[model samples]
Target: MLLPQVLPALVVGVAASLMFLGISFLSEEFQVVLWDDLPDALGIGRYSSLWMITMLTATGIAVGLVVWKAPGHSGPDPASEGLGGAPLAPGLVPSLLLASALGLAGGVSLGPENPIIAANIALAYWLGRKAQPSLPGAAWVALASAATIGALFGTPVAAALVLSEALSSQPGRGSLWDRIFAPLVAAGAGALTTQLLAEPSFDIGLPPLSDPGWGDLLAALVIAPAAAVFGLAACYLFPYVHTAFRRLRHPMLMLPLGGLVLGLLGALGGHLTLFKGLEETKELAASVGGWSSGELAKLAVVKLLALLVAASCGFRGGRIFPAVFIGAAFGLLAQALVPEVHPAVAVSSAVLGVLLATTRQGWISLFIGAALAASPSMLALLCVASLPAWLIVTGRPQLELDHEGKALH
Candidate 1:
């Protein structure tokens, strides 16, 4: 009986996943050409400090041009938008898609999540209204957002947890599960679609923690709050950085300027600090022992700053991906500082803290942290550690801004 009502959501979810994967494919192809083929043809090292600076700067200019001349100014300032902001006009989708693809391929410190979600929402809303005028717009928004979240994380559970939080806060008529039934079906279909097509995985292969001990608990208590402070610093600074860029008064000036700063940051932080930080975090984890405490700290600081700048200065992307990198770096730094602390515990706890501050979504943060650690024992530690971290960020300004340019709580 329920299947009849949910059939449309399932179809929409599959379509949304295909759209997300399609954009990702285009971004990867462009990334290879820009960083691999073009550099090879020019006989320049792709990771060379100078070349990274050049490419990032050029990417900024290109994205800026799109924003300045393209429709809808690339779908609003990224700093003012959250992951599931309102849908855009369908006509604005192409420019947003182009900007997002360029930012991803150009090594900006933002993720494909935000722009991709916005694009999907707009498309779904427009098409769904045309097909069924009686279905409320919110239904399309809910299904599209759920599908994208599931596809992004390669799991239906992520969408379920996130939507549970969202739906719990709203005044709805049905039981919570009843309300989310269609979205859950959508999320499941999206997750399966991406799983079959992309096979994305968040586990970075860190050694598992078979034993839980007092020392690990102490490490979580200390490291999680410390990492949360780092994330809070960015949250506090977000509005100011955004204001500074707004002073430039045009995308042509601010975005190119932002790109130049990002290029310099890339040079200082080295190649690891470049891009959205998913693959880079894996590389960091693979050679965790090779880095000194200072090097790990530097990577975290640099990536955090890059994320701040990219999101603030009109770049079309999300902050969550770079926040994950910062968390991993700080976690590794904690282990570097105290040899007794288990790496899995330290990493997950730190990830929990940073994500709590940056994303303000506890379930998603906990899920990402636990996924990376891949240790059953670390779950209790992360849940406990998240309490203090959550308290720190609960009443404070979020990383995003409201309409008047003030920070959102």
Candidate 2:
């Protein structure tokens, strides 16, 4: 039993590793070309970084074109999908892979989770069928999803917690550990490979939390629900945004127009508010002390709206990366307004609220919030904050949009 678990994990892990490695390589090379080679070779950026805005605009248009014409509709509109899905036929894989590469490289403000998850599932199934034909199709989906998630987050435990909740809700045979054994094996291998390739760290390098005060706890209890309402505001607007864009009824027209509008937003918000926001999150954190409250507020507002536009306009990507960045910005703004509050408490609490409202994954929300400052005390506060935060959005529709441009249930 253990041998079977370990063996499939080894195979699936390698496939996932190679899949993400290729994507990272392509994304980097493409960025170099778009933001570096093309700019330098053309003597652009002489006056300002306005050239970046132009590049992002063009990227939006180009990606829209690919999504419109790509085979298999780029393997499904990301607005309607989650991070994982069933294995696709080999014939429908290429277009998704290409579109994802383009989006990742072109600075389309989306992550590679969806396409990579689907791609890994397809590859894992092909290999699994060759070597172990007895594995159920659902088992392949679980294995691939867990492996890819572990690789992406650089932690096997994330997969474990996520799968634990997911599997508990479904009817299944065997003990929970027995069902998750192979997935954990796959997660561990995948996380190890990803760390070796490139460590996936989301830390903002905040001061460690040693002592969290009562004020901090009270503020967290209050501020976190406020952030949830802030995030839920976008959720309410999501359907309207999607419906407005869908009225164009064609990706070519709708997406390019969205790109142009997004480019204008980038122009107003500057580079810090652009991209999927991993790098920019670090930039924001490092420069938090220097930024004025007004500037931080602008960043929080601009990025929030930009995320809405990008997702509503048919760009392919995941929401978690940008959502975390949004939470960080909101936290910074809170700290700016109230200098007496602890930075770690503010940031982690705001993240807890935003992520809970956005991802609706309680463990991951609290995990990410606490991990920001590496503070156990803050984790306790987020635990308190999350209950009320969960209540605020319990009956609200999710941020995802369906094919008809409506919010999901």
Candidate 3:
């Protein structure tokens, strides 16, 4: 009896792995072309303020066109979708990609990475339906989509963990086989995609812990509660904040708002907190050795608030990257508050926010903490910090979902 179920899962895993890998390759090329040539093509930096405004307006119009003409092509964002079991429609992939690209190119506060992952999932769903028609293509699409996301994020394992936790809202009641298959496909897809894209693995290089003593342990204990509180605050406040976005009543208006906000931020800081802040966050962590305590705190606050605002205000993106940046910066600041604790230890402790908010798995945060700093010792410290926060947040619902599994107002 179980064998039949297991066989189908295995098949889904294998097929999803292949599809995700292929799409990852395509996405990589797409990213490179878009990132390298588009800015120059648009003369992004050479124009006057009016020209810049006009360009942004044009981009907004484009996004508006896509969103208006195409339904379900936008909203709520990737982390929410992954958390809420939102179904994917493959036909929406082209429109979403176009809109996401326009947003990314126009310097919106959104990240294309998550949208790309989602697009691939949508693609897989469409293909599976066209081929098998009768099979549970939705599940396979999700599995394959997850695999692509993991691979693209450079930590397919972490991707797997987050998706599994999000899908299994009942904790231990869902089909364990589904959970297993999804991640397995995601890992394979992620690895293959990463390879073809020439993207480096998720290894944010931080100095190794020289001597993680009792001081470090103490710091982790302190930071754990604080991180959980911060996460809870964001989750609780999200609905109210996101309500501003819904009020726009039109993508045209919302698109311009996204561009204006992104433009003001980009013009002020030269992309400091724009985009996903993933690469920028990693760079900041590397520069921590040279930054003063004041500088670290400032960076932490800016990134955290920017990310919160972006997510809450109808920006299209994922919180995962910004969360990493926020956690890293917060960790650095925590070290300053407690001089004895290592910065690496502080970073590990800070990564628990996302875990507390949605992804309730301890290992995912631990791996992210470790991967973000590229230090096994730091990762170990994160494991210590995230466990308690995970326990605390899991018992409570972080997000409200409607019958369709969409986020509620």
Candidate 4:
């Protein structure tokens, strides 16, 4: 009975993954040119503080022009949207893509998730309607969102967990598994497609936790909530920073100004604190033994600040990836401060806390924390740690903003 829907959903999932990978590849190429090839050709150090400032500033101006002149103003400020907000009209996809690509290439401390998902949703909704006039619009939304989430994390489990939270909140028919069946299929297809092509990975190569103990539990309980508090700090600051940028009243001015500020932050934090933070998180983890507690703390703080400014000042991107980086840095800092704590325990717990605060999505937070630590043994500890952390962030202002510019709860 469901084969028809299932087949189309699978196809949409594959298409969505392809779209994400294609955009990422192009953006990375541009990033290399701006941050690598051009710098080498000009005899300028790519990571030189001055060059960082110049490139970021230039990137800001360029992105601002796109947002100002491109169709649909790049489809609303990202601060006002969540991971699966209303899909944009097809007309706005190009501008959104360009803006996102520019931001990604320009060292914006945000990820491709938001704009890419939005673009995919818009495209899926438009095309799906054309092909299957009888299918509900919500069906297309579910397929596209699931597919994107799967592709983003390189696993269908992420999509399933996220959608479970979302579905439980709404009125639905049939069993939970029954309702989620199609989306899961789509998610599986998307995850498999990305896995085959991009080989995306979340593990940061932290040592595995082969054994669990009371101390590990204690570490998780403390570190997770602490990291959540750190992330909540950003949530509290979101609206104020967003309002400050809005004062500029135009993207061209707002974005460039934001860029200049980000450049200063990059200069302060170095290249490690720049960009979306996925690869950088690995870099930090690989060299975790060498960094002092204070240096790791500074790296986390500066990256959070950069995320705040970039997301606030009209950059089209997502917060999740950067938040992951912040969590990892904090986790590493925790390990540095208390050498007895297993690196896996500290990192997973801290990531759980930060993600809990920033995303307000328990499943996603827990999943990401475990994935990064590459330690299944830490899951039970993370689950318990998440309890207090959830309380700390619950009912508090979220990182996302409403149309009135107030923080969403």
Candidate 5:
């Protein structure tokens, strides 16, 4: 009985770890190749409206080629794919990775990091099955899945926490080795890749934080429930949006529709809301001192709307990047209201919004929030704010999709 339980976990975890290692190398290689070769080879220049349009057009064409040629690769919006919480098809890994890379690199306003992580896990399971056809199955696949997730997000703790919560959410379940082993191996591999590639660290600049006063804490208390409301709404709306788009059923039409909607939103919100959040978020954090609380609030609303539309359409990626973007906007707004606290503290606090909207596990949310903040003071605030966020989210409706692409009843 013990052997049956443990063996699957070990095999899945190790396989996931190896796959994580390989994906990290590939991710770096893809980035370098695009930077060095794409610019010179394709003559794409400094990103501008014209350049972005060109890039978007190219991405659509590329997506068209792939979707037409490789049918198995096409799936639901990957940002919400995790909401499915089911094992992925092994053959889908390569195409998923390629599509994500193309989407991210070609300026289609998608992030590949999460998809890469998921793909690595799928690849791990495929390899393991080939090597050990007799390996017993358990929740080890979930563990391995967590390991790959940890590698991408730069925090194994968060990845592990998510896996544990996912398992516990199912009740009457126990720990799976796959969850622990793969993430450990993948995180190790990812760290090695990060060091060797000298990848730029994610730096969100916020001023030093002061201790949270009663008022700040109270505001956080209110914000937690508000954030949970948004998270639940997102979980509810995403599937409908996806279903509506699928009814159109044409990749060519679907992608351009995404581009048009995104571009229109960008025009309304300014181009800052258009692409991935990295550059714009850093810029926003730096300028938090200049904006009024109300203006910052508007940015948050717009970002939330934009991200919802982006995910609902046929976009091929994750919401975490845009969630950070939306959270940072809220932080800046809150800073405008609470000038007494550090801007970093405000950013850190607003991040609860992202966590609440995304997961039931408070620690996982806090970990991601603190990772984005990258400061000891911010981490402390994250722990405090996460409490109420967790409580509010504890009973929110879940977004569960089954293996057959149907919502679980």
Candidate 6:
């Protein structure tokens, strides 16, 4: 019994690791070319403004071409699909991988989570169906989702938190773990594998909150809602952006146009504001002491708009990484203005707000806020902050697209 469950998870871990290998290698090479090798080869100084623009513009064009009339078209607009969706047809796998590779490496402001999830689902499903023809389709989805998420976030907890609702709703469960036991097996293996490979550290480097005061709670209440409002502004603008781009009616045109605009935004915001927020967040955190509140504000706005543009223009990936970056920048801005507030409270509250506003996952948002800020002392404060933030954005539309790839008004 245990062997059957554990063996599949081991397979998932190995497969997911293999996929990450390709993504890391290609993306690293792309970065080195734009920032290092290509600059010297072409006689231009490294990190030149021109190289930056060219890299992004070229990324947009290349991504657009791969996604245009390609075999998979990148397996559907990721904006239309949330973190999880039905698996893809086998034929779509080739194009999905290509699109995913481009999006991950080509400097798009999205992460590898969504496409990776889809790919994992297809692979796991194929294996499960062939071996265990008696199993339900939902099980395959759950298992694949768990394995991939575990691989990406370097923890099974992220997958478990994100999937709690789905698991809880299942009809015949001995316990939540019983239903998710196999996925957890896959998750543990996946997390272990990723950790061995990447050694990722998500600590956003904010000063730890040692003691929380009422002022911290109060600040959280204010900042969290403000962050949510900013997120709401983007939500309102998303449909308009998509509609405007749809006017072009062709990936060849719309995507490249978005790339140009994104490049301009990057020029406006500088290098710190580009790409998925992982490494950049660390850099921003380290430099918060030097930046003006105005600069921080610009970073936040640019990232939010960049996220909208990237998602609207058919870039395929997840928004959480970018949202985390946006929240961190906004939080840094808050701290700059009000030095009295603990960095932990300010940054966590800000993260909680934007993530709640965008994903509407209250628990996950709170967890992320606590995790990224590395402030266990401020967990209660983050919870307090998350309440009002969740209330403010509860009924509003989310940062996702509908079946027809149109944003909800």
Q: Per-residue CA lDDT of candidate 2, range 1-409, in tens?
A: 6566688886787678678878878888887887778878888862234775677677777877787777776766667776676678766677778877876676666667778888888877877887788887778788888898888888888889888978899998889999999998888888899998887787888877798788988889987898898888788898898888878988887778777777677777777777777778878888666778898888888888888888888877777778888888898889899988787888888888887777777787887888787767787888888999999978787788667667875
Q: What does candidate 3's lDDT look like per residue over 222-291, in tens digits?
A: 7866776666666666566556665787766766665565445444444455556666777777776676
Residues 3-36 of candidate 1 have per-residue lDDT tens digits of 6548778888899899899999999999999999
In model 6, the clashing pairs are: none
Spell out the clash pairs found in candidate 4.
none
C-alpha lDDT values of all predictions:
0.90, 0.79, 0.59, 0.92, 0.59, 0.80
Off by over 4 Å in 1: none
- Candidate 2, residue 138: Cα displacement in angstroms equals 0.7
Once superposed on the true structure, which residue ranges of model 2 sit more than 4 Å away at CA?
A: 46-49
> Distance from true position, residue 195, model 2, in Å?
0.9
CA-only RMSD, every prediction: 1.0, 1.9, 4.7, 0.8, 4.5, 1.8
Best-fitting candidate, measured by lDDT? 4
Clashes of 2: 0
Give the Cα-based TM-score of candidate 5 against the true structure.
0.78
**How many residue pairs collide in each prediction?**
0, 0, 2, 0, 7, 0
Model 6 over residues 1-409: C-alpha lDDT tens digits?
4456777667776676657656767877777766678779989855556766777788888888988978867777666788778878867877877776776665678777777788888877877888877777777777888888787878888778877766666678477767778788777778888888777778978788788888988999999999999988888787788878888988889888888887788888888777887788889988767889999999999999998998888877788888988998898899899988777787788988999887777767877888887767778888778788888998887788797756653
> Taking the tens digit of each residue's C-alpha lDDT, what string does model 4 give over 1-409?
4677898889988998999999999999999999999999999999999988998899899999999998888998789999987879999999999999999999999999989889989998999999998888988999999999999899999999999999998998888888788888999999999999999999898889998999999999899989999999999999999999999999989999999999999999999988999999999999867899999999999999999999899999998999989999999999999999998898889888988898898999999998987877888888899999998999999999999999999
Error of 1 at 141 (Å): 0.6
Per-model TM values vs. the true structure: 0.98, 0.95, 0.77, 0.99, 0.78, 0.95
- The positional error of residue 357 in candidate 6, measured at the CA in angstroms, is 1.6
